[model samples]
Target: MELWPASLAEITPDLYATEEVESEDKEVVAKFFALGSSLTWYVVEAQKLEFGDVLFFGYVHTGDWNSEWGYFTLKELEQQRYLGGIPRIERDLHFEKKRFGELDLEQ
Candidate 1:
């Protein structure tokens, strides 16, 4: 699936847009995950740079003990690959937008 699709752009707030909002109140606009792994990214906002690159801000879940909110770029996600060079990360097509507090973060 296409990450940073136009439809997503329409809904995602610009970078820093939610900085003033409480984490739980922020709206997660999209979800991405690594195939065959538990890693996940819950995008809350994004910004399209002048050079045509997109930067995303979200909560990243790397493991049971390691998860945090941070900024990531589309290029970074695309560059991640499995041993066979297959793209490892993919957008969760079935994901629906929701408040961050509604997420089952324990997963």
Candidate 2:
């Protein structure tokens, strides 16, 4: 699947655009996850770097105890693969924009 579509890039805010907003109030623009893993990413903002790569910032839930906000890149996600060489990460096409506080992170 195409992970970073033009439609997504149009909706996602540039990096640091939400810096003034409280964490809970930050709007999550998109969602991504590993096809067969518990890992998930809630993207809040993104920016194209000088090298022409997009960098994403948001909440990453690796597990119940390892969720945190940080930066990741398009290249990193594209490079991920499962044991059989299947692409691992995929964007959640059905995701709707919502505030961070509205998420049911407890799952």
Candidate 3:
């Protein structure tokens, strides 16, 4: 994984215990974004990660989850091109060629 190039700090238990805790962290949450966009990109707050916590993130061209262009495992992030999610896009041309390849060679 790229490690997001960000860090998380420890929050005080007392501050997080109050009913207003969520409100207090509103600004902090707003500033936390996994990916940077051309319009709004900045290094903001840090996120506290715990053991066994699943760090699930998807790489998207337009930030559209439904329009998934690819998928990626955390392992792939170490490579430069694999920084973003892997593309699962279906190309009609490629699919057709693949299907053709599956046919009997004699034909």
Candidate with top TM-score is 1
Over the stretch 1-107, how does candidate 1's per-residue lDDT look in tens digits? 57779999999999999999999999999999999989999999999986778999999999777799999999999999988888999998999999999999777
lDDT of 2 by residue, 12-102 (tens): 8988899999999999988999887889999999998777678999999987877899999988898899777889999988889999999
**lDDT pick, better of 1 and 2:** 1
For candidate 3, write residues 1-107 as lDDT tens digits: 22332222232121223234232232221111223331111111222345422132221233343322122322233232323644322212211111211322221
Ordered from best to worst lDDT, the candidate numbers read 1, 2, 3
Q: How much lDDT does each candidate structure score? A: 0.92, 0.90, 0.25
Those runs of model 1 whose alpha carbons end farther than 4 Å from true positions after fitting are none
State in Å the error of residue 17, model 3. Answer: 1.4
Candidate 2 wrongly placed segments (more than 4 Å): 50-52
Error of 1 at 67 (Å): 0.5
- The candidate maximizing lDDT is 1
**Model 2 weakest lDDT span, ten residues long:** 46-55
